[model samples]
Target: MAEALDQARAGRDAAGTALVAETRAVVAAAGAMSARFRSGGRLLAFGRNGGAADAAHVAVEFTHPVIVGKRALPALSLGEDPSTLPILGRPRDIVLGIRPAPDDLAVAREHGMLTVALTMGRRRPEADHVLPALSEDPLIAREIHVTMYHLLWELVHLFLEGETEA
Candidate 1:
């Protein structure tokens, strides 16, 4: 039990340190994407089997504000609705392809939506920004998803707090 606890703490520490360094860069990138979306841009998120949850979580974080002190940002998850996807097949709208394609990423970039891809399979689209995650082990993948989102939420909260104060 003691060993397990220690290992967990170590993991948390590592994640935290890496996040502290990475958060500013991510926030800047996300903010740029958000700006484009504000000017009639949309968000397109795609993932394979494991990517589905990561895509969904990101969508939720942007669509609905989770941080207690931050405002909600506009975002969409293409994978969540099979029915709607059929109607909105265009790249301008959020579309989740079954597989990755170079064209897909290009379209997403062209349309001004930040492309977020989650995959454990052959690298496809080559998104403008790729957030690599565990492709194997379902449990580990879920943990990664949770940890990544927590970091994102914290960064967003910080940004929002500064904005409101200003």
Candidate 2:
């Protein structure tokens, strides 16, 4: 039990370090994302890794605003499949594709949408903003992505609400 706990702690520590490495990129991406939202663009998230949880998580967080007083933004999950995007996506919208398959990635680009990705490795060829997974362990990947997305949901407000760092 102690061994497992230690492993988990190490993984989390690594994930935090990885996130720190990506901090500047994340800030830039969030700035661009904030601009999109300001221009009446909505966020459309999709996952093709056999489940819709990632997309659902992103959509819900953006649409509902987990923090109090943050305005609810428009967002939707395109489900577990990728084909729906070509039909549903608009040029002004941003596509947050989670572990997208090649086909979905292609379709997303064809739609001319601003693309961001949360993935397990290097940025997929399709994602303009790619956040690589911090660890190879599946559990670590999940933990990192959840924390990353949640941080995104919270920090994005700073850009949108005109808050400056103290």
Candidate 3:
């Protein structure tokens, strides 16, 4: 029990160190992405298996931002709601993969939206831009995913105004 506790504490310490180092980069990328989302465009995030869960968590973070003191940013999840499931069902929506067609990439690029692709392999896409994320080791990736979003949520609050009543 003592050994396990020490290991956990060490892990937490390491995570905190990584977070502090990468906060700026994460903030900048999320800011650009957030701008695209706010400007009449949607951030289409996708991944497989646990990556999908990370994608979903990111989608929820944007759709329902949990910033302590900020306004909610406009975000949409491709697989979150049954209503928009139609969008995904249709071939028109820009889907992420190694070789998403130029036309499909254009669909997203033309809209000035950010295409956030989360994959665990070497299938990079050609889009307006890409934010390469870590997802190889599931354990660490999931932990990073959680930490990344939490920081992002906090950043949202840091940048935007507090929530308001409709």
Q: List lDDT for all candidates, in order.
A: 0.50, 0.77, 0.48
**Cα deviation in Å at residue 35, candidate 3?**
2.3
- Those runs of model 3 whose alpha carbons end farther than 4 Å from true positions after fitting are 1-19, 67-69, 80-111, 117-135, 162-166
In order of TM-score, best first, we have 2, 3, 1
> Model 1 scores what on Cα lDDT?
0.50
What TM-score against the true fold does each predicted structure earn? 0.56, 0.87, 0.56
- Runs of candidate 2 exceeding 4 Å displacement: 1-5, 163-166
Q: Give the TM-score of candidate 1.
A: 0.56
What would the per-residue lDDT of candidate 1 be over residues 1-166, giving only the tens digit for each residue? Answer: 9999887666655544544554555565444444444445444555555456666777787668754656675555666333343344344343333234445556555554355443322344556554333234444444554665555555545645554310
**lDDT tens digits, residues 1-166, model 2?**
9999998898878877888898876777777778778888888888766437978989999998756899999999988876777788888888887776655667666777778777765545567788767676766676667777777777778888994421
Model 1 bad stretches (over 4 Å): 1-25, 37-40, 80-104, 119-125, 134-138, 160-166
lDDT pick, better of 1 and 2: 2
Candidate numbers, best lDDT first, in rank order: 2, 1, 3
* Top candidate when judged by lDDT against the true structure: 2
lDDT of 3 at 127: 55
Which candidate leads the pack in TM-score?
2
Ten contiguous residues with the weakest lDDT in model 3: 90-99
